[model samples]
Target: MNTSIRRALGTTALTTAALLAASGVASAHVSVNAPSAAQGGYTVLEFRVPTESETASTTAVTVELPGLASARTEPIPGWTATTEKDGGDLVTSVTWTANPGAGVPPGEFQRFVVSAGPLPAQDEVEFPATQTYSDGSVVDWNEATPASGEEPEHPSPTLELAAGSDDTVASAVAAPSSSDSDTTARWLGGIGLVLGALGAALGIGATVRSRRS
Candidate 1:
């Protein structure tokens, strides 16, 4: 084999391998594994954060609640947590701070829990999470507000709250419009008859024209 050809092939192979490794690294981050909340009541939510570092070990993590919503975090060993309250009657404020132990090695995962009360009046609620890495990096998981206002991909952790049965499910229901349905059916039927008559007349005109021609 020629020397130049061998060199080019080796370079191509190295580039391909590097691209694959970089793609995997770009996807790695801290994320919530599972979340739970109760309906019409306060619930403690737990988030499992995985910190993966190639060069530096994670020393601490800070999670900020959006809109300063009130929450209390469960304590972990070798870690300190705190909260901030709102002055007005609006949603309260809270935050969770975590510190890794000295014996903790690199690429370690941790868990933090928080308690929040009097959830909003929606059937579902989402908590957009932001994670701060030891290397001064931030990851935000809030994404892609759907058409139905529900995001499936990269969705914020969500809690489903079912409405009470006595809350009159009928009020939530939307009644079908009989007038609109009738109008649609009438338009379709009229269009069909018009098209059929036009087709028949065109066929008869073609037959007469052929006879004359």
Candidate 2:
């Protein structure tokens, strides 16, 4: 093969391998998401747990919520949920245990949902989790990311709290609105989307050609 063609093929192969590896490891990391959660607000939180063990199933999970005002877990048919509260009766932690033969199997995942909180008034919140496998092993997803922002091998589930909803709405209402400006912005956004799609298509075509060569 010519040098250029060989380089293109090598780049494509490396890119493909990187993507596959990322996707493979991503699910193995337990994570949480609450897109609309705001400071001192109540919102639904979803904690997604994946069974990372090749030979064992996930049997239990425990999440720490030290300052949450309250929490309620959405019931899973084959799972039982419990909470522990501090002296002031605020939920401090929650645990979910899978029933017999109901553990999340290897390569599969389950999302545990919670409707909780007057969330703590903090910029970031971490929900450190402990995972138990049916094979009598436990894993802690409790490491805090350092100031350098490099993710730890088993990073804790975290959420960055936004400003309260009232502040957001007030800010939006305070912004000047103009039909003409809105129209122009939408037109530009549409063009950007079209260009982005075309770029992706060309990228795919180039990769396919490199592979077929």
Query: Candidate 2 at residue 74, lDDT?
Result: 99
lDDT of 1 by residue, 1-213 (tens): 699999999999999999988764543444443244434445676665555555544445445443323466776777777665444322333445545543123566666777765444467766666656556666565674688974344445555665533333332232223454577899999999999999999999999999999
Cα lDDT of model 1 overall? 0.57
RMSD of each: 23.6, 25.6
TM-score of each: 0.49, 0.74
- Model 2 lDDT per residue over 1-213, tens place: 599999999999999999999887866799999999887678899999999899999999999995565699999989999998775566889999999989899889999999987776678899999999999999999999999988789999999989777664354334332444677799999999999999999999999999999
Stretches of candidate 1 above 4 Å error? 1-36, 58-70, 89-93, 100-107, 145-155, 164-213
